[model samples]
Target: MIRLPSPAGRRQFGVAVAGVLAFLGQPVPLTAQGFCFHPGPIARCSWFSVTEAGVALSVPSDEDPNLTFQAGALANVGPRSAVGGVLVGAVFQNDVRLGVRARYRRWLTDRLTLDVAPGILLYNGTFTADSPGFTGELALGYADWLGMTAQLDVVPFEFGTET
Candidate 1:
């Protein structure tokens, strides 16, 4: 579970941030009124992932497929676009990797959404190598009952880079 700072600490931090913005002459979000990225209509305000489970496509290295799980926070940047980050971890019999990636989510339809994320991973196992490498993911989801998704996870260092 996520733990939040105390109310007094949060208020102090907010005051410090607003002071800094004022010193720099930057428009303060805390004091700004009716702020939106654009004058157009807005979409959902924000989102926090509960939990999602899906299969992962990884570089062939083990006898079993990878299962991945992700959780994170997101905020809408546009009518159909949301930006955020995720902490992704994969489990395989012979492989384990953890990745942190910035995500860009776009709504293709009212029910369909696509996520594109590129980041780095800490690869650990005999399937690839015990090294840090580039990671990319593409996911498609139907965000309704069951909240199902399919995702492809790629580690693009095994083919060329070696350690």
Candidate 2:
């Protein structure tokens, strides 16, 4: 059995979320107009995921697949266009990285859209390599079903010059 909030409780929770969203410079849905990067044209906070596959420039002690958990905000930059960024953390492995990314979303209709984003990334890991590495990625994604999106990126890292 699942416990659900009462109507009054739900209202208060919604109001609190609205205030936090406002501080993030995002629009409060069904209330005011500021900036929104919703699922389609109507819906806020779509659940999404991003996957990345790439080879490290420097070979490590143990070569394994790289993966992380992704979540963050997507904002509309213009008509038929929006920008979104995500933070991904590791769950299993000896390393974790925090990535800041941006994407361009183009809407074909109110329910469907396409997007591409290229952004810089910073990596931190527990390997013999450098502490932080500079990187960039490009992704193509599809947005549907009330702002939900799935994305894949081909990321490549450019190791800094050895001093």
Report the number of the highest-TM-score candidate.
1
Model 2: per-residue lDDT, tens digit, 28-121?
Answer: 3452244444354333433223343333322343646555554555555445555555544443255565444554556666556665544333
Query: What TM-score fits each model?
Result: 0.58, 0.45
Error of 2 at 83 (Å): 1.8
lDDT of 1: 0.52
In each prediction, how many residue pairs overlap at the backbone (N, C-alpha, C within less than 3 A)? 0, 1
Query: How much lDDT does each candidate structure score?
Result: 0.52, 0.43
Per-residue error at 131 for model 1, in Å? 4.9
Which one is best on lDDT? 1
Q: Could you tell me how far off, in angstroms, the CA of residue 98 lies in candidate 2 after the best superposition? A: 1.7
